[model samples]
Target: MTDVSVERRGHIAVVTVHRPPANYFDFALIHDLADAFEGLDAGDCRAAVLAAEGKHFCAGADFGGGGAPGERVDSSRLLYREAVRLFRVGVPVVAAVHGAAVGGGLGLACAADFRVTVAGARFHANFAALGFHQGFGLSATLPRLVGAQRAAELLYTARKLTGEQAVALGLADRLADGADPLPAAMAFADEIAASAPLTVRSMKQTLRAGLADEVAAATERELSEQARLWATEDCAIGIAANLAREVPVFVGR
Candidate 1:
């Protein structure tokens, strides 16, 4: 069964990620997302609202899941490869973030053109706390949204920002008036769909020029760094701490 679904509402494609509770992503899910976005590029989808059906929008990768060390590294590589394809798509996307978007999940939200979120939602770059480098092209996308210093602060601290705070920092585009972000996101997508298609595409192309290539390069470095860190004593400790809901004391081995 596919965890991703695409629904058409006129020119707006509502692409939803379906993984309940924490909504942790894997290679298959990211690959499915890229496929959905690329498929939209070929059709009449002028705009898309990226939504999720679960408690959390995405809680990043499931570190607690079973996988051999080498298999885990390979999966990360494949996931990042598919993630880069999301940046190459031309369709404008507005993410409806109703809950937590953590680690690479935050990177996924940043990949969109705009994010419509609620104040209750949390945006976290938790890779550092996980004892790994940030992946999923966040090194490129996060800096582009909130500047180098702010991105560094977020990545370094692994801080969680509420949606209002994210909007204040220019990380999120809009804070929804209602509790849920889907309606607001759809409205935002409608605004994009209302524009002249060719001109909109031209503007997007100009504004996001070279972004895909930049993300691709950044992900390459991020993957390499993460691979090295995954074998560290700190990584194991951090993951165990996270699963246990405790703060980790990294020895920096």
Candidate 2:
């Protein structure tokens, strides 16, 4: 089954991430998401909303991607590239975030010009917890939204921020409060769609340029951190502890 589902809503294209049981990212979802965004970027839609069907928009990279275990380190870069393309697309994009937006999922939300999350949405950049590298321009985007101090706290500590906290920290543009976020996001998307597409696109592009430098720097930092962390005993310890439902006993090796 296709993990990513895309459909048109008027001039708005609604994309849903359907990978269940936490909706972990896989190569297929990444590629299919790219296809969907490519189609949307081709001028068929004036706006789009990214929504997930399950409890999460995404967990992160599939641990099984490089093979089940003890395998090569294969990763999916499609989501990253496609997201950059989509972010640079000359149209409005709204992300409707609910449940857990963890690791790359938060990065996905960052790609959108606007976002709405349920009041109870959970925001996290738990890459450090897994000893994995960051993706989806998060290195640049997170700090850009949450400031250096807050971003560091979230990333370095792998703390999960609540939806209200996310909104307060400026990671989200709107919170669903007591209502379903999808409708509010769709309404907001419609509002943006009603505006001149060129103007809307230009504004988004212009606003993001300042963050581009940050994002680029973050890309290198994330890669470096990932490389170092992946080689240490910490990664396996963390993963094993997570899988085993136990607190990691860091040896600081």
Candidate 2 clash pair list: 140-215
Model 2, runs deviating above 4 Å: 64-73, 76-83, 210-217
TM-score of each: 0.98, 0.87
- Residue 59's lDDT in candidate 1: 86
Per-residue CA lDDT of model 1 for 15-117, tens digit only, reads 9999998788988999999999999989888999999998888888888875666787898888888888989889999999978999888988988999999
Q: Mind giving the per-residue lDDT tens digits that candidate 2 earns over 106-184?
A: 8878877777987788888887776556666887777778898988888878888888888888999988866358888
TM-score of 1: 0.98
Among these predicted structures, which one has the highest lDDT? 1
Clashes of each: 0, 1
Q: What is the lDDT of candidate 1?
A: 0.91
Judged by whole-model lDDT over C-alpha atoms, candidate 2 comes out at 0.73
